[model samples]
Target: MAWYMNSVEDLAELYNRVKEKNIPIERVSDHGHAIGIYIHDPDGNGIELSYEMPASEWGHDPSGYMIGGTAKGRLSGPWDEALARQAQVTA
Candidate 1:
């Protein structure tokens, strides 16, 4: 399952809080149009916590389905709280 968050900062905060609880998180990864953290429920059901990238950065297939590439080398840490705050002010 997948859950969407508003921004990278929001996702980062959630990740930090979840981590402090000692819940096993699988990994953090980028999916082109989003960043995600993979985890499993107590029963082992897969879950993804994700933050969608801006629509301007999203790509689509010929059939109009969103097609995202892997972001294996992208950084996922040290979210710029300032940037998020700026965005909120401008938005």
Candidate 2:
């Protein structure tokens, strides 16, 4: 149902482009381990584009499997910076 993206840069780029084109973005979210950008299709189905924290940054179990809970929070990062830059550009 969600989590599809490679990097924050890619997410920011897509988001900015969408906004520039006046397309509606459903929402954005910062889940401790990842950043998610949500959008809706013409059909009204929701899609999530996200950038996940690298494995090296994640907590690992004794056997080396990554384990942890994602903290739900506000949207942030390169995405926020992107919005700011757009504001400056349009102003």
Candidate 3:
């Protein structure tokens, strides 16, 4: 999915709420400190909600791509800046 969370605990709670409401989740995974959760919306598009830190040693990045973090060896893209910021603000 294009957007997601960065905290497993929060994602877990959300997942439970949706599931309790009769929503079905496609799958879930634990990528170290990150938890990847997926669900298919009514239109059949797979949406993913996850909790993973940015791929950077420092806390913030202006260029949107800072290296050196736990996700190093994992094949993944840089954290979406807008998505990350939204998560932070909402949290």
Candidate 4:
């Protein structure tokens, strides 16, 4: 189960809200141009919330299929939250 978000900032906001509500997030990761949040539903079904970077930032193979790389540096937590807030303000 998964849902795609529009931007990293959107994902950040969702993450903050979910945390505020005491929802347990299993994990968070960055997959190149995208970020993913893994969580479980009340029924214990796995769910993933994803946010992809803009098309301009995406990498493509020769055949034009999108390619993703492993995350570099931190993907979530206070630093990301601060960045997300700044992005929101700028946007």
What digit string (tens of lDDT, one per residue) describes model 4 on residues 41-63?
99999999878766656767778
Local accuracy of candidate 3 as per-residue lDDT tens digits, 1-91: 6346555456657666767787776555545446566778899998887767554533346767543333432423332333355457769
Misplaced by over 4 Å in model 2 are 1-3, 59-78, 81-91
lDDT of residue 33 for candidate 1: 62
- lDDT per residue for candidate 2 within 1-91, as digits (tens), equals 6756677677778777777887777665666677877788788888887888776766677897656636443336656654455457769
- For candidate 3, which ten residues in a row score worst on lDDT? 72-81
* lDDT tens readout by residue for model 1, 1-91: 8888888788888888877897877665555566767889999999998887777566566777666544332435543343345457769
- lDDT (0-100) at residue 2 of candidate 4? 94
- Each prediction's Cα lDDT score? 0.68, 0.68, 0.56, 0.69
Stretches of candidate 4 off by over 4 Å are 59-91
Indicate the worst ten consecutive residues by lDDT in candidate 1: 71-80
**Comparing candidate 1 with candidate 3, which one achieves the higher TM-score?**
1
User: Which candidate should be chosen as best, given TM-score against the real structure?
Assistant: 4
Clashes of each: 0, 0, 1, 0
Alpha-carbon runs more than 4 Å astray in model 3: 54-91
TM-score of each: 0.61, 0.61, 0.52, 0.65
True-structure lDDT of candidate 3? 0.56
State each model's C-alpha RMSD to the native: 10.1, 6.9, 12.0, 8.3
TM-score of 1: 0.61
